[model samples]
Target: MEKAAEFYTLEKGILALKDQIDALAETDDLDKKDRIAALRSEIEKEWARIVPQLTTVNIVQIARHPKRPYTLDYIAFLFQDFMEMHGDRRFADDPAIVAGLAFYKGRTVAVIGHQKGRTTRARIDRNFGQANPEGYRKALRVMLEAEKFGFPVITLIDTPGAYPGIGAEERGQAEAIAFNLKTISILKTPIINVVIGEGGSGGGLGIGFGDQTLMLEHSFYSVISPEGCAAILWKDQNAFEQAAENLGIRAATLLGFGIVDKIIPEPPGGAHIDPEQTFKNVDKHLYQALKKFEGKPVDELLDERYKKIRKLGVFEER
Candidate 1:
C-alpha cells in the first residue's frame, strides 16, 4: 500500500483510527464516546512524534499533497472582489497563469499566480500549471498595468516549471521569462511573492521577485525539481531522495541562506489538514508585510529591493 512509506504509516494509522471513531461516535453508547476520546489522544501522540522526524521527501510529498490548497484556493480565501484578467494581446490566453485585479484589505492590488487544476481534465486544460511563453507575456502585461495604476503586485508561485514544449520555445519562452525578470525587478510599486507550493525553475522566477519574498513552512523552492536533478546528475530518476537532500529547497534551508524573507507557519499536519487556520496565518503575515512597506517612497523601495537582490549568495572571506 502507498501508506507503507515510512512517514505515511503513522499518519495513515491515525486517520484510520479517526475514521473508526467517527463511525462509532454516531452511536448512542457511552462506551463509544470513551473510545473516541481515547482514539483522539492516540492520534495526537502519533502526530507529535511523526511530524518532527519527517524526511525532506516526506515534506515534499505534503507540499504536493493532492488535497493541499493551491493558488486559486489561497486567492479565494485571501482576496475579495477578484476580477480575473486574461490573455497576452499578441497570443491566446494561457490557462496555466491566472492574472487579475483584486481587493486585498480594502486596497486594490494586481494578483498573478500559476494555477494547477484539481481534476485530470482540468489539469490538461491548465497544462498542469506549466506555463508557456504566452502565459509569461500575459503576466507581464498585467503587471505593467498594475504599475501604471500604482497598485502593489502580489504573486503566488506554484509551478513545476515553465513549459518546455516545442511551440513554447518557438514563441520565445526564454525571452518572455527574461522580460518579466527585467521589468519586475525595477517596477516602481511594492510587490510581495509567496511560494505556496513547488517553486520550480524560471517558471517560479518569472513572477517571483518581490519586495518581500515569503514561503510556507513545508513548501519547497528550487531551480529544478528533484527528479530532474537526479536524472541529470546520476542518470537515475529513482535517486530523487538523494537529490532532495542535496538541493536545499526546504523553507528552513532557504531561510538560513537568506533567500526567503520570512517563513509562514502552516497548520499541524500541513496546510491541507487545516486550511482555515493556514489562511488566517497567511493573511496576518501578508497584512503585516504590506503595512511595513506602506508610505515608503517608490525610489526607496526600488533601492532597497536592488540591495536585497545584490546581497543574495554573498559571503565574507574568512
Candidate 2:
C-alpha cells in the first residue's frame, strides 16, 4: 500500500473505534466504557509513533493527497466576502491560479493561490495546478492592487510546476515568473506565503516571495519536483523516493535551513484526515503573522525583506 493509504487505513480504523464508542455511549456496561478508554489510548500512542517516523516519500504523498484542502477550500473556510479577481488584462484568465480580495479576520487583504481542483473535469480545467504566464500576470495584478490599497497579500502555494506546454513557453513563461519575482520582492505591502502543498520550481516562487514564508508540516517545497530530479540525475522516474530523501524539502528540513520561517503542524496522519483542525492551525499562524506586520513601517518591511532574500543561500566555508 502507498504510505498515504497506510495512514488513511490507520485513521479509518480509529474512526471506526470512535463510532463504536459513540454507539455504546447509552449502554450501562462498565467493561464497554473501559474498552473505549483503552481504544482511545491506543489511538493516541499510534499517532505519536507514526507522525515522527514519516519518511520523505510519505510526506510528499500526503502533500499531493487528493483530499487535501486546496486554495479555494481554504478561502471558503478562512475568509469572508471573497470577491475573486480574474484575468491578466494582457492575456486571458488562467484557471490554474486564483487571486482576489477578501476579508480575513475582518481585515481586507488580497488572497492568491494555486488551485489544483478536485473533480477530474475541474483538474483538467486547472491544468493540475500548473500555471502559465498569464496566471502569474494575474497574480501580479492583484499584488499591485493590494499594494495600492495598502492591503496585506497572502499567497498559498501548491503547484507541481509552471505549465511546460509549448503554448506556455511561447507566451513568455520564464519572463513572467522573473517579473513577478522582481516586482514582489520590493512591493510596498506586507506579503505572507504559505506552502500548503507542493511548492515546485519557479511556479511556486512566482507568487512565493513574501515577508513571511510558512509551510504545512507535511508539505514539501523544492526547486524541482522529486520526479524531475530523479529523471535528470538517474534517468529513472522510479527513483523519486531517493530523490526526495536527498532533496531535503520537508517542512522540518526547510525550517532547519531557514528556508521556511515556520511550519504549521498538521493533524496526525496529515491534513486530509482532519481538515478542520488543519484550517484552525493555519488560521492561528496566519493571524499571528499578520499581527507581526501591523503598523510596521514600509521602509523597515522592505529592508527586512531584502535581507531575508539576500540571506537565503549564504553560507560560510567550513
Candidate 3:
C-alpha cells in the first residue's frame, strides 16, 4: 500500500473518469459522451486543489511512497566506500535496521536507518522496516564506534514504529531504545538526524536525539498514529481526519513546536516525484548543519545539545 506506483493521489477519481469514458464510447447516445467530458473536467479541477493539500493519512501513505528515497538509496548517492557492519554481537544481524561504516560527502561517518526493501519480497525480508530490539542495540553500538573514532554520525529515521511484536518485547524493546537515548546524550561526535518519512513513537526517539533534527516536508512524526489516537479518543477509527489535525504531527507543525529544528521542503507533487531533487536539498542542509559544529569544541557542543533539549518546556509565569 505504501508502494511507489501508487504515488498519484487522484487514482480513484481518474479511474472513475476512465470508466465513464469507456462507457460513453460504447453507448449510442451523444449526450452521454458530452456528460463524460464535463465530468472529467470537474474531476481534474477538484483533484488539482486537493492533491497539494493532502491529508495526514494520505501523507502517511505517500511517506512510504515506494519510489521514495530509502536509506540505502541516499547512502549510495551521497556516500561511498560503505562497508556494512553486521550484528549486535549478542544476536544475529538485523536487516530492518541497517548500521554500517560509510564515507559520507567525503567524510567517514557511521550511518544508520530503517531499511525497507523495494519489493513485496523485500518488505517481508525487511519486516516492513520495523526494527527489533537487537537492531536498535546494533545501531547504538555503531554510533558509539563513530563517536570513539571522532567520525560524525548520521541517523536516518523512517519507520511506522519499533517492532511491537511479542519477540521484540521479550528481548527488551523499551530498554534497547532507552539505551540509545542515553548513549546519544553524551556521545562526543556531532550527530545529525533526519526524519525522512514516518518517525513514529519510540522507534524514532531512540535515534532522534541529535545536535540537529531535521524533517522532510509532508513527512510526519507522532506519539501515536492517527488511527490509533482516533480509536482511543473517539471510540471510532473513522475519526482519523479530526485526530490527525489534533496530533500536531506534520513537519511544519513539529518545527513550530520546537520538536524539530528544520523542515526540508520536498519537490512539488511529493518526494516520490523527484527523489534526486529531494536528496540534493537534504545534502545542502546537512552540509550546513554538519559544518555548523565541525570546528566547535566537543564540550561546548555537548553543552549546546543539552541546552537544546532543556529548552523544550521552558516557560515564564507572568
Candidate 4:
C-alpha cells in the first residue's frame, strides 16, 4: 500500500495546517479557539482551489488510499440486517469477495463486493482484494439466488485485478468471470453497480454489469491499474502518471463516456476525509437509481440493458 504522505505530497502544506488545527482543538485558550476557526476557513479555500485541479494520478491515489472506506464499511453504513453468505459449494470460500443478502431501506437486496482487509494480516488473507475463481463463483451463486426471489442486486466494485496465481488459472478464473458477464447481462432482477474505489481490470468487471453504474467522484475504473499499464506499455512502472491520464479512468471521464450513469460526489479531499457524508451521498443516489427501475416491466428492463451494453464503444469512421 502506498503511504498517505507519499501520495498526498501535493497537500503537504494543507495537512500540516490540519495538524495545527487538531492541536488547537484540544486547548481551551481563546486565542487557540480563534485560530481553529481561521485554519478551517483556510483549509476550505485551499481545498476548493486544489480539488478542482487534481490530476488523474492524484485522483487514483485518493481512490486507493488505505484509510478509504471499503466494501464492508459501506455495507455497515448503508444496509441493515446483513447476513453474509459463504462458499461456492464446489470449493472453499474466498475472503477477497464478499456476497450476501441485506436490507436496503427496508427492502431486501443481494450485495456483493471486493473486500481488501484493513490490517496487514487481513490484507494477506483477503489476497489484497484479488479474487480467485471460487470467489467469483460465490458471487454468482448469491446473484442467481437474488434473481430467484426477484430481488435487486447491488454490487460494489473495488479490486486491483483477479488473482493471477497458477492455482487460480487451473481453477478457471477467466471462465468464471466470463460466466458472470454472460449471466448478469440477462439476469431478470434489477442490478446496480457502484465503483467505490479501485475498479480495476476483470476483477471489478466480474460483477460490474448492471442496469445502472455509479462511481465515487475520486474513484477510478480502468481496464488495468495505471502501474500495470505503465509497466506493460512503457516498460516502467514509474510512468503510471502518464498511463493514468491516457487511460481516462477518472469518474468525470467515465461519466463523459456514458460508462458511468452517475458520479456521487465525495467530501472535499476524498471519501476518507468524511466517510459519513460520502455514505449519505451514495445512499441518496442509490435510492434514486433503484426507483428508476421500480415498476418497469421485465422485458423493457432487459431490452434497455441490452441496448446500453451495445451502445458502449460505438463510434463512426469519417
Candidate 5:
C-alpha cells in the first residue's frame, strides 16, 4: 500500500491542543488572557507549519476528514431555512447526494454535494461520499429545477467518485454522468461549483459542470485517484507519491493547467484545521464568481465553459 503522506491532520492538532489546554486549565493560577493566548498561538503555529507541505494524498485525507464540513453543514451555516428535495423521481432518496433550495447570498440558489460521514457506520450510510447513479440523477433533477426557476446553482464537489456497483451500472452510470454535462450545457441560470475535497471521476463531474468553477487550495480534482492511477500504470499501489505528483491533482497545478477557473485559498493548514476561516474564504470566492457571471449571456457562458475545458491540457511541440 502507498504510504500515507506525512502530515498533521486537523484531528491530530485538535487532540494535541486539547491536551495542552486541559493541562493549562488545571493550573488555576494562570491568567485567563495568558492561557487563551498560549492556546491560540499553539494552533496558529501548527496551522502555519503544515500549510506549505499539503500534498495531493494529504488532501485526500483532509477531504475525508471526519469533522470537515459537508453539504448539510454548509447549508446550515451559510443559508437560511433550507428545504431539502429528495428522490430521483424514479427510485428513492439518496442521502449520499443531498439537494435543496436555499437562500444564499441574498437570493435563492440550488445546492447539491457529496457528504462524507464522520464514523464508519455513517460512511457506510452515505456510501463514503460516493454517489450512486440515482444520486447524480437527483442532483440533475434539482439543477434543472433551478434552471427553470432562474435560480443560480451552487454545487459543492466532495465525492471520491460515483458508485461503481452493479446496480449503478445497470441504472446507466455513464449515461447519467453524460446527461449532467448535457443538461448543464444550456442552463440559463448561473452555475457555481467548488471542489471542496476530492473531486473524483464522473461523480465529481456530475455536479462539477457549471458556468464557473472554483477549488479550495488543498482540494483535489482528478479523473482518477492516485491509488487507482498507481495501480493501473505501475501495477503497484505503493507508488502513490509518484502517482499523486504525476496526476497533477493539486489546485495550484489544476489552475495552472486551466482545468479549474479559480482557486480559493484555504485556511492556514487546511479546512479541517480552521473550519470557520476556510468557510470565510470560500464565501468570498463564491460571491466574486457569482457576481462576475450575473449578467453574462447563456452563449458566452457555454463558450467560456467549453474553452476552459478544451484547453485543459498541454499543447506544446513534441
Candidate 6:
C-alpha cells in the first residue's frame, strides 16, 4: 500500500497545512481563528489548482489508496439489514468476493462486491481481493436468487484482476467469468454496477455487467493494469506512468467511450479524504439510478439492456 505522503508528493505542502488545521480544531484558542482562516484559504487555492490537473498516475494512486473505502465499508454506510451469504454451491467459498441481501432506502436489494481487506491478516485471507472462479460463481448464485425475488442487484467493483494461479485455471476460471457475463446481461431484474476502485480486467467485469454502470471520480476501469500493460508492451514495468495515460482509464474518459453511465464525485482530495460525504454522494446516485427502472416491464428492461450492450464499441468505418 502506497503511503499518502509518498503518492501525493504534490500535495505535501497542502497536507502540512491540513495538519495545522487539525491541530487548530483540537484547541480552544481564539487567537488561532484568524490564522486558521488564512491557512484554509491557502489550502483551498492549492486544491483548486491541483485537483483538476491531477495526472493519470495520480488518479491511479488515489484509487489504490489504502485508506479509501472498500466495498464492505460502503455496505455498512449505505445500506441496512445486510445478511451476508457465503459459498458457491459447487465449491468452497472465496473470501475475496462478498454477496448478500440488503435494505437500501426501505427496498430490498442484492449487493455483491470485491472485498480487499484493511489489515494484513484479512488481506491475505481475501487473497488481496483477487477472486477465484468460485467467487464469481457465488456472486452469480446470489444474483440469480435476487432475480427470483424481484430485487435490484447492486455490484461494487474493485479488483486488481481475477486469480491467475494454476488452481484457478484448473477450476474453470475463464468459464465462470464468461458465464456471469451471459447470465447477468439477461437477468430480469434491475442491475447497477459501481466501479469504486481499481477495476482491472475480467476480475472487475465478472460481476460488473449492469444495466447502469457508474464509476467514482478517481477510480478507473481498464482491460489491464498499467503495470501489466507496460510489462507486455514496453518490456519495462517502470513505464506504468506512461501506460496509464495511454490506456485512457479515467472515469471521464470511460464516460466518453459510453462504457459507464455516470461518474460519482468523490471528496475534493479523494474518497479517502472524506468517506462519509462520498458515501452520501454514492447513495444519492444509487437511488436515482434504481428509480429509473421502477415501472418498466421485464421484457422492456431486457430489451433496453440488449440494445445498450450492442451499442457499446460501435465505431464508424472510415
Whole-model lDDT values for every prediction: 0.87, 0.90, 0.82, 0.91, 0.81, 0.91
What lDDT tens digits, residue by residue, belong to model 2 across residues 1-318?
Answer: 465685566467656755676677778887987887786676667678777777788888889988999999899999999999999999799999999999998889999999998999999999999999999999999999999999999999999999999989999999999999999989999999999999998999999868999899989999899989999998998898899999999988888877899999987667876688899999999999999986689999999999888888856898
For model 3, how does the per-residue alpha-carbon lDDT over 211-243 read when each residue is reduced to its tens digit?
A: 999888878888987778899999998787788
| Clash count per candidate | 0, 0, 2, 0, 0, 0
Per-residue CA lDDT of model 5 for 128-195, tens digit only, reads 98888888889989998998898889999998889889988888989988998888777778899999
Go through the candidates in order and give the C-alpha RMSD of each one to the true structure.
3.1, 3.1, 7.5, 2.4, 2.9, 2.3
Q: By descending TM-score, how would the candidates be arranged?
A: 6, 4, 2, 1, 5, 3
Which is the winner by TM-score between candidate 1 and candidate 3? 1
Which scores better on TM-score, 2 or 5?
A: 2
User: What lDDT tens digits, residue by residue, belong to model 4 across residues 239-273?
Assistant: 98899899999888889888999999987667886
TM-score, cand. 5 vs. native: 0.89
Model 5: lowest-lDDT 10 consecutive positions: 1-10
For lDDT, candidate 3 versus 6, the one ahead is 6
| Model 6 Cα shift for residue 202 (angstroms) | 0.7
Q: After superposition, how far is residue 240 of candidate 2 from its true place, in Å?
A: 1.1
lDDT of 1 by residue, 1-318 (tens): 252255566468666866787788788887886787787777667778877888888878877776778888988999998999999999889999999999999999999999998998999999999999989999999999998999888898889999999999999999999999999889988899988888988999999977999999988899899889999998998798899899999999998877899999987667876678888988988888888876689999999999888889956898
Off by over 4 Å in 5: 1-15, 18-38, 316-318
TM-scores vs. true structure, each candidate: 0.90, 0.91, 0.84, 0.92, 0.89, 0.93
Residue 265 miss distance in model 6 (angstroms): 0.9
Error of 4 at 166 (Å): 0.6
